[model samples]
Target: MPNEPTASLSPRRLTTLGHSCVLLELAAADGSVRRLILDPGNLTAPLTATVAVDAVLITHPHPDHVDPSQLAALAAGRELPIFGGAGLGSYLSEAGIDAVTELEPGEHEIAGIQVRVGSAPHEVIHPALPLPANLTYEIGGVFAPGDAFARPEGQTEVLLAPTGAPWMKLLETISYVAEVAPQRMVPVHDGGLGPAHRTLHTTVMKKFAPEGTEVSVLAPGQSLEF
Candidate 1:
């Protein structure tokens, strides 16, 4: 059960880059740090330029979640793999991206990190709209369900809940958080929220989150260690 999440986890930093993108830096006992970028999209493109990343993770292939040109440029010759679900690998390949590693519902090692992909279908964006394959990323002491409300197996210390999206409401977010019941709930997918609205989300989520769960809101360019 070494890979299974524990009630308490070691220290790690989660840096919010607006929207779904974040820079996760995991520290090992030897003082070595591994950095990974999750959901590097249009909203976070500017910030990612200067940061060092060992790998890129895509939750889905939406333009907001995955920018082909940006990803192509980022992975130019670093030989870093873009870890994602089967669909993402195909999407990246068709987009002419190299070093694509498609994953399924299971645990795998990437860049010396234990990454897990959950088996869950994405929430309905719209009946008229097509839902591409979405990958849930469980790594670096945090669980990111891409664009879905699905939870990962075992316990997780932190959950990167999607708090802002046109496809969901406040109630759904609260319920999903309650269901997962993680020790910490950090709002992601919030690029669309303005100052007041962003504040509102933090306030409301804090109000209704499970008793043991704490809501931490990290705005663009903000970093929090947990």
Candidate 2:
């Protein structure tokens, strides 16, 4: 066999945050870069320290997924747009954030980019009180399924997914990626947690990844181009 030609079908670049934080940069035919931060949990330190973002696509409002106070830092100094499910609007308003826009499973355009919100399941354990309206966001060939994982029907070049311990079951994560069928899949929501929750990092990749899925386990403070 000729190595299966993996390079031709893989993502161009990828950066992993210690605990499931990922920043994916996609190259547009027009030569501009479309950057997306999925589930920006506890990203305040990282963003302030080194990284600049153009836009943020939030899938849900879990503390690990959407760190309001920290995310606000990115919105500061520059006018960055934050897009999330309807629930995000309320949270943004309460946080006194002016640049946040909430989407309700529809198509939206921003900064010359097209974003589509797909459906996802919230925490099966606590489906009500913190009832999150999870979203599967597709923007410029990148798909991010915050914490939920009901695969959207479409073709995606890269997938930023939750492979951490708290958010999903190992098998469920594997099944989601299998269904979506992306050219490349990167794991998130991993070590962002504390010592008591480290096992999630191991289990996700060990148990969930499908046979053919390409998985990248990124270290904190690292970045990639795709």
What is the C-alpha lDDT profile of model 2 across 1-226, one tens digit per residue?
0111133433334556555456655555575655566667764244542445667877877776778766766566677788787778777677776687877787876555677888777756554555678888787666777666766568777777665554467667677787877777766666545655545654555465666666655556555445
Query: Where does the lowest 10-residue lDDT sum fall in candidate 2?
Result: 1-10
Instruction: Judge candidate 1 at residue 135 and give its lDDT.
Output: 84
Candidate 2, lDDT over the whole model: 0.64
137 Cα displacement, candidate 1 (Å):
1.6
Query: What are the RMSD figures for all models against the true structure?
Result: 5.5, 6.1
Cα displacement (Å) at residue 129, model 2: 4.1
Clashes of 2: 8
Per-prediction TM-score, please? 0.87, 0.77
* CA deviation > 4 Å runs, candidate 1: 1-11, 28-31
In model 1, what is the error at residue 80, expressed in angstroms?
2.7
Clashing pairs in 1: none
